[model samples]
Target: MLVRINPASCPSDGHLAALTGERAFCSEFKYRRGMEIFGEGEDAEYVYQITSGAVRTCKMLPDGRRHINSFHLPGDMFGFENGATHRFNAEAIIETTVRITRRRNVLDAMTSREKGAMNLIGFVTQNLQHAENRMLLLGRKTSLEKVAAFLLEMDQRQDHPDMMILPMNRRDIGDYLGLTLETVSRALSILRDQNLLRLGGATQRRVELLDRDELARLDA
Candidate 1:
């Protein structure tokens, strides 16, 4: 979903480049770990591109459940809405920096710059594909399978190939995968025991896929 907002209506933050009448300039801002970038139902005034670190976008249910929609990594873009307000909350999963531009400016560029427009389409396509895959993971996969697939995903997204340094904690992973934190922890322990992965780091955020092929088979 995409939201379009007038640049003049927003606050005069130095982080907003469109305030200076630039066509596509963006200003960088820093977000501390666990800081909320935007909240559900808030005005969708900016489109953000992550320069470093990671972010999680999630929806809160009336019963206080959270369903994480996606995790945005460095070089990833997020915070789009189909209406005037956002439907989910976005927060930094780690200390992060992002460059933000007005949604209006980005929308204007979509029509004027061919390359920019193509990039938007490509990014949207990727999100759609990811959503489909996630649906399958949530609806059909078992607890073990879901955890395996998630580890593989983080491994790939972290771009370390076979090893991963997870930025989010067990509760976040549980919420994203529709499992209890105990379940998530148990699955990782089981995988470790099976020689599928090796956990390092004091907090166990560092994980090395010991047998990628076996993990892939387990995920399948």
Candidate 2:
């Protein structure tokens, strides 16, 4: 099943206000590409929802390597922490705008409304499922398999299904998949030469899956 986030389709303030009996305490903030939104171990005072553009949540290793946990596209909600501190550092993958609300306010609102609590539970459950699937992908997939899987995921997540325009860079992809940047590039080249996909666009971020069945077989 293909699933994508669309900010335009997100519930308006009215719907949320109806459920919680309180208006959402939201404020819009903009960040330039590569700007840090929040740092690891920082206080988790707020929950964030993407209004436009993309964000990457990552952690820095002791060896100074970066490990990307996930990408937050438009309409995606993130920054839910189990404790007071953030576990990952979040940054803008491109010029982005996000709506942020105080975590305490959300919890207080949910406490009064059963529907709101259930919605929050469902949202967190979906994120956990995605994390589990990624764990499996990273642990056992081959280099080519990983790249194919990543492309398929991007296709499913993007606003456009026919043409995939990735927002993140090769380094980000490598970090997410536990591969080197060179490995990721080589895999894409191999796939293109095999006629499984066509890569276009100035930065080669746009792709069209030529033989999706073959790509899926490779991913499997």
Worst ten-residue run, lDDT, model 1? 12-21
Q: How many residue pairs clash in model 1?
A: 1
Residue 122 CA displacement from its true place in model 2, Å: 1.4
* TM-score, candidate number 2: 0.88
lDDT of 2 by residue, 1-220 (tens): 1123332323334323433444565667788899988999999998887877899999989999999999988767789899999999999998888777778877788887878877777767877899888998999899999999998888777753788778998989999999999999999999999999999999899899998889999988
Candidate 1 regions exceeding 4 Å error are 1-23
Model 1: per-residue lDDT, tens digit, 1-220?
1222333322322222222223355666778888888999999998887777899999888899988988888767788887999889999999888777778877775666546556666767877999899999999999999999998888787775655888889999999999999999999999999988899899899899988788889888
Candidate 2 residue spans exceeding 4 A from truth: 1-23
TM-score of candidate 1 against the unseen true structure: 0.86
For all predicted structures, in order, the TM-scores are: 0.86, 0.88
